[model samples]
Target: MVRTADEASVFPDVVVASIQMAPKVGSKAANLKRSIELIEEAAGHGAVIAVLPELANTGYVFSSRREAFELAEAVPDGESASAWIDVARRCKIHVVAGIAERVEDRLYNAAIVAGPKGYIGTYRKLHLWGDEHLFFESGDLGLPVFHTEIGRLGAVICYDGWFPEVYRLLAMRGADIVCMPTNWVPMPGQAGEHMAMANTLAMANAHSNGLNIICADRIGTERGQPFIGQSLIVGAQGWPIAGPASKDREEILYASINLKETRRARHLNAFNDVLRDRRDDIYDPMLGTGWPLPRH
Candidate 1:
């Protein structure tokens, strides 16, 4: 529930919103309705961009591939995508949200990027989590950054945050802000409601790449799997500016950010720039030698 600034007086570059909501399994109709309501609410608050949790339309933790396929739909043109696009257009805001994508017999854990003009692009989850391996294919669209009036935008979903290469690649492509649609679960053997490791990863990557990040996570248990809901927005300096919201609640977090600061923030002090200071010359050649350097 943190407000970055007095959104009323100071008009920052953009007011971004991260929507955290729990979607019921197999309840596409109800999910879509609820998502639309939340989106409208975000727009009402003057948010130029909004991010929603992963698998927002269909929910997570499907029992089987058949169940997943039944809930999945085509990207950009499907019922769920169209509804979100329509809402974004009506609200005059941009939206990044996850959806279960179906391409013929294959399925992808994907997120859709849409703007006031219309649909922008899609990002398939590069890394799949447990049980997801049986239902979804590895993302084929490497990492894509979309250019708009607001800034250069990129996206990743859920487990993709684990790989620093994902953020690096996007930053190398001139991404200013990265939208993450996640359904985070509690870490193995970790107890007491401390911050999820996922949030730390987001913060670290943001600082490393000098990029702003918006993370939206879901809450509640589906079937038997439980989702942790510590959604947050981190500035380029790698600090939470909005929230690590309630562990189990449906809410929206807003952050007023100037994406232009990403470039400035990279210049740490006077001499060190996060991206420029990278020892790429020493790292690139060794990358192919299986030396543990990030390839993508």
Candidate 2:
């Protein structure tokens, strides 16, 4: 039997926290203030890596293109992002939050990763969901893994989690953790009903790829659309370490990610390997091999 080792000695255990927020629409200043407060709270509790929800600076539902544009700001230098940077630097922790980014006249639904040093990197949402396409351009930056002093970190927005390839690609690139900033809404019948589908997706992806996933979701309803809040942090083994926080309350969820265990756990057994056993020679669209035939 393969046994687990001393977690602290291998690599410092990563204390991660998720902030499930409720941002008032068109309230940038108020939103920014609240986010900073929450980030500080997480940092105070020894969370080295903290994540916030989608469009955290601006409310999720937009009444007009002009509003989204008005709310959108330049990353790193943007009002919201800069404020977050200050908090991250002050608290000496890494912060990843979703924001609306504008370049020229085009706007992108994006997330920015900031740490104690300064801004690390950004990721625009690759898969735009529902009404998002009407307001923002699909992400062009692609999936980027930021190598930080803590570990290899990656960011993916709300809708991007639905695609398996997104998780797979991040894992293939040696990403140890993924920060998911989401504004999760209920599925067709999920409203105030069963467990949130978003949580299930995160867990499954983590287990399948041996990746730790931290999801921060927003609470409350906006412009008649209600967000299903159940922010959670899943370990590399696909177990919820912190929460599926209350569906209607603003809260924080915490978990510790062991990078060494992730690398070790991927071995599964002496026989099966999650990533190494892949038949990448077959299905990748870039290969120009077309659809593979039956294995007769």
Candidate 3:
């Protein structure tokens, strides 16, 4: 594991929190206020890092394009990002929350990372899901990892979780922790409150990539669409350290993570390295040129 002199000497137990709250449709003000409350609550509990659900400040289920358009704001200059930056600076914690991003004429499904120092970076969701395609422009920024005082932080939003490449890219970039801001709806044919596919995906992604993943999801139905509220803070071992929180209640989940151990855990054994053992040479021959047209 490659570590900077500063990072190597500063290993400490860090607490991560995931906030699961219900966001009202078209109520941007109420959603931002509620998000601030949850953030304050998490910070008070000694969480050094906190995650919030997708479109946390604007809410999901926009009645129309104009509704989404009206609610979207500019990136670090936006009110929502600026507010979160203020709270993060005041609480001395890192905040990762999803918001609607408006850049000139385009709107995007985006998440921003703010810390005690102020706004750090932004990640727009690379993959669009369902109605989101109608509202958001596909993310142009590739996977980026922000180096921080605590550890390296990487972020993903909602549908981006479905792509293994997202996690692999982040892990390869040496990210110690990944914060996911999601708005998961129930998948058809996947019934009951068993483990949600979102949780399963999070677990599998964490295990395969050998990085800790913290996920925050919303609860309650908006515009006849029900959200699967199972906020989680996964350890480096790919298991839940905190919660899959309740499916219907608004809650905050917290867990302590040791990032140094996570860096060591990526080595499966003396004989195998998860990233080093890839048969990419063979696979690349087929994939390097992009899909070679569908097999006849």
Candidate 4:
């Protein structure tokens, strides 16, 4: 439901769903169909926001740049994006999902955000991983926060979560929640018992920023590249409210978040606030120039 500003103030709690699924390589139609079905299921279960995995429609592990280009489409105007917008409009919920975005001859690993009101925005993956470098350009648009009745929303993709700056920038802009669509591969030396690095990063960032984060991951092997699935929803306090679902399962994890509470939690005590405590005076103003020395 597209709540009015007054209604949002009256109702601060919003249920979010993280959909974990396996998208077959090159099977765009089937993947989108499955995504729609899962989104409908989330709506039926009372989710106001639904997040899907990176490359949810086209799948990961493309064979070549040519293959990736073939799967890519224009944002908000492409077939995949249009279908998702339609589903969001029909279900009366917000949808954040990953797609291969084409802008002329260039392609990007991107996420499209849509709502009951229609298209919202897109977030291109800033950090590329492994073979992705061969198929997509690094995102040029810096982190952007989108305003909604529920609260301010932001998004990042896969490897972007590894950098604290991504979450910090979003929180600095007053974001209450972030949608992460990822295809997590087993990290180097990852054992069966160790907690997935992706989940750990989500929890730590959410706690540090006092922001809710929904991480939706894909499962299964595509062209011999296996993806780990442990999709989860983290509360502002950095605790898992729903799941680190099974390593290889198609499921949706749900959690209810109160934007007011999330914003309120940033105050660690009377003397400190997470964002307020940052010593921006000493930190480098120009990002990507490497760390600067603190001024005397």
- List TM-score per model, in order: 0.92, 0.93, 0.92, 0.93
lDDT of 4: 0.91
TM-score of 4: 0.93
Whole-model Cα lDDT per candidate?
0.89, 0.89, 0.87, 0.91
Q: Which runs of model 2 end up more than 4 angstroms from their true locations? A: 1-10, 191-193, 285-296
Over all chains combined, what TM-score does candidate 2 have? 0.93
RMSD of 1: 5.1
Query: Positional deviation of 148 in candidate 3, in angstroms?
Result: 0.4
- Residue-level error in angstroms, candidate 2, position 70: 0.7
Give a tens-digit lDDT track for model 4, residues 64-122.
Answer: 89999999999999999999999999999999999999999999999999999999999
lDDT of 1 by residue, 121-183 (tens): 999999999999999999999888899888889999989999988887777777889999999
**Residue 49 of model 2, lDDT score:** 96
Instruction: Look at candidate 1 and give me any clashing residue pairs.
Output: none
Query: Model 2, 165-199: lDDT tens per residue?
Result: 89888887788999999999878777655778888
Local error of candidate 2 at residue 44 (angstroms): 0.4
Model 3 earns a TM-score of 0.92
- Predicted candidate 3, C-alpha RMSD: 5.6
lDDT of 1: 0.89
